[model samples]
Target: MAYPDNLLSRGESVVLSKRPHWKMLVLPIIFFIVIVGGGFTLAAVLRNWEYHTIAWIVIGVLGLLLLIWLVVVPFLRWRTEHFVITNYHVFFRSGILHRREHQIPLGHIQNMETSVSFWGRLLGFGTLIVESAADQPLEFENVASLPKVQSVLNQLIMDDKQAHRGGPQQGGYPTGPTPAQG
Candidate 1:
């Protein structure tokens, strides 16, 4: 999904935008398959028994509830979750029903790290932990292409610092008149 540019400062732009890794969909996909398969299996078994009408009704209701919780909810949660890194801020927004958004400015960031477990290394995705001065650390979990994200964030932080300093701009252009003539 495209980010709203109105929220950004004039010169600022998104450096990286991503959703959680496909690994996150593993459990939801499994649950979806199980729910569908179980529904079919229950229907077949009910057909074998002539007096299963009432029992089938009860099972169907329970199955639907389980499907909503295990399959549908997880899918929606996964779809809504987002992690974004812009020149000025790191944004994390997530939730299925009531959403929550957290932002950490690059200037406020005290420390950052990239982490990967054995399984995460195997999957080629990792997490980014960002700690700022005023607030608690924010974890961007299950980030796809984590190394690239880390590199881009570092570059953005440097560029942001340079932008605020106004000493030199891109392509080695000075913000003020050079003293070479004087």
Candidate 2:
């Protein structure tokens, strides 16, 4: 699903909207295969036609449960996940059963890093790590189009710096009272 428009602050523009890369699905796919394989294997072991019928029924039910628990739940969680870079903030939201949302304002961001292993680079995806002054670091794992995101973040940080410089400095020596100069 697309990122929710209502989630954006007024006047905030979206720069990038992304889901976790397909590479993240690898483990879930493998889990689905294992569940199906085990189910079939069990059914095959009960060779008699009469026993086979019961085994297939039992296997089907058990397989469904396992698929829901190990494969479907995670896949849905991945689907629900969203990573958004906005002019005002970086947002990450995810959850299958419970909703979670985190945002770090552009002005508060201290650093941004990109990482790609050999396989990740080959696959055209990597992780984006964002460090903010007021919040914990965030690691966006297996994000596609990592280079583009990094470039955008660099631009945003530059813009933020320029914005800060153009504004009046917020704090310094006390304005209300002056120490006796003499």
Top TM-score hit? 1
Model 1: how far is 138 from its true place, Å? 1.4
Model 2: per-residue Cα lDDT over 61-93, one tens digit each: 989998998899889988999989998888999
lDDT of 1 by residue, 63-89 (tens): 889989987888788789988899789
Cα-lDDT of candidate 2: 0.85
Per-candidate TM-score against the hidden true structure: 0.86, 0.82
Instruction: Please report, in order, the local distance difference test score of every candidate based on alpha carbons.
Output: 0.84, 0.85
Angstrom error of the Cα, residue 94, model 1: value is 0.8
Q: Would you list the clashing residue pairs of candidate 1?
A: none
